[model samples]
Target chain A: SQKTINPNYSNRGMTLEEDINESNLYYLTNGIAVIHKKPTPVQIVSVDYPKRSAAVIKEAYFKQQSTTDYNGVYRGKYIDFEAKETKNKTSFPLQNFHEHQIEHMKAVVKQGGICFVLLRFTNSDEVFLLEAKHLFPYWDESIKGGRKSIPKKIIETIGYHVPIHLHPRIDYLKVIDHLYFNQ
Target chain B: SQKTINPNYSNRGMTLEEDINESNLYYLTNGIAVIHKKPTPVQIVSVDYPKRSAAVIKEAYFKQQSTTDYNGVYRGKYIDFEAKETKNKTSFPLQNFHEHQIEHMKAVVKQGGICFVLLRFTNSDEVFLLEAKHLFPYWDESIKGGRKSIPKKIIETIGYHVPIHLHPRIDYLKVIDHLYFNQ
Candidate 1:
């Protein structure tokens, strides 16, 4: 049944990555927000062109990233974020983030960008948009012998739950509108 | 001498990539902007651990990129672009750009993000930022039997010349302030 459905179509129960991408696309098309996934860059060393239409990369290496995975502007405010999914329902580990990423988020917030993390609990099918201001104390506490992670309970208290929808899939901007605009 | 110099020092005479990166770093550190170079993603098929410190990537494949190389938010506006260099002194061939990249830039522009190309004529030691709106027609014209490329002279007429500087390296934000902020 999944095979019979359109591969790129939005209606087949999307993953968190797919859902966020679809929601961003909806936002873009409707002129609501302009967010994009930065391209995954790879260094190519060798390629085999066995056929004109088929070029196979034979050797390559992943380069260290100097930036976040997603960023853009929303309602004249800079928004920067990274998304991660975990199967565990109990706690979200600090180890999920890299040192450079934490440093990057701090820089974004300093520059007045609305920085956040999108955490998805796959088993429970829940997603939350947790702002960086809330994340900062925990990030620092992480170094001070706090739990090596933020428990799901804290996330539930501070972060806004992004609802899943049939049309837009993630529909996170709606939550943004409510949290940032309506308030 | 180059090795003894602190590669990360802001005051050092950095290379072109270094300048762009440091400018981006300056933007990040100052909270004036949030821009970054995306990581190159590679599919690692094999790895060898001959030494504890260095993990040699034995086999890998370069992954195709889905978007432009650099993008971020500045003063609440999304900025997206690709950086390119050419040895040709007179003309920059259109073939250097992929169809997917053009499509990606178009999408960003359509979504109200500032989209453009940061081109460098290495031979002439000049760099220019050419807007997408100015480039699209030329791209179309080239495909339809007009000039197969955009000459440096034409670019000089249309593009905003990015001034070289000590701190912000590329110093494209100055051009942005003049074009968008002044308006």
Candidate 2:
């Protein structure tokens, strides 16, 4: 089987996460921001401490993250968000998000921290930034057995389309500056 | 040997970490702030997916944290800090901190985020809130074969004393209010 890499984002030969990480490094080195992806949460059940070697965890289990994946300070404001890439072209399924994550987003909003979701439609090679405030009502309706996903068109209209760039890859912060800071 | 609980802070039956955690929870539930302790980072080596149960990690190792233990949003300001407790009544060892963590704090401060350290002298039953900027020179000097620790009196002079409280436990935010916002 052969795979064709989309020339748009594939120029760097990176996944969405790698692109974001590289962009974050760029941000960090340039004194632009201090955002970081939190490490995967794990539950250690057993460990062995040897005499000469480092301690090894013999048994552990993955734990569902209680909060959004990425968080940090940017321009004197607290920033937090979750990023997900979907192959679905028509709509981005609500199932891509977890319940507790929504709750966490609500809390972050209440604290006046910036919160949002980054939706990458891989099939279309496009990305969008949707603020958590705009996303809440749809999530509420979703729990009441409404539309299981937000149509791509609606996302295009309501969300800020994040244009991919060479140096920073996805310029989500540019979208953020336009939306939150009136820049 | 029976552990004696000090009436001052031990009345709540919590260590410095637990006290901070309970306080964070208090702040979160009351809509005051949103802070979280980052999960301990682990390097996963192998895993097994048994069809019947949750995936189990067979081999892993604990990794040194690259940043501070705690961070979040408070009063719309980005908040980040490291907390440590010491039984040494005369001095707090600089060895308790890592180089990368200090660099991370420096970057955070440059971004205008509020960064500090919570120093709990367990034997003396005192806690102090020391800004990251104040601690940096000491760290730099220590690296150049200067004093290996910060004297307790110097800490008391430069750091704001955090009075223990029943409701919020540490009342660090109060110190932040005074120091950062001139509350």
Off by over 4 Å in 2: A1-7, A11-13, B1-8, B11-13
How far residue A81's Cα lies from its native spot in candidate 1, in Å, is 1.4
Tens digit of per-residue lDDT, candidate 1, span A57-110: 665555545566778767656678888888888888887777788888887777
- In candidate 1, the residue pairs with backbone N, CA or C atoms under 3 Å apart (3 or more residues apart, or in different chains) clash, namely A41-B40, A41-B41, A42-B40, A111-B31
Alpha carbon deviation, residue A120, candidate 1 (Å): 1.9
For model 2 the local lDDT of residue A100 reads: 92
Best by TM-score: 2
DockQ for candidate 2: 0.83
- Fraction of the real A/B interface contacts present in each candidate? 0.43, 0.91
The model with the greatest DockQ is 2
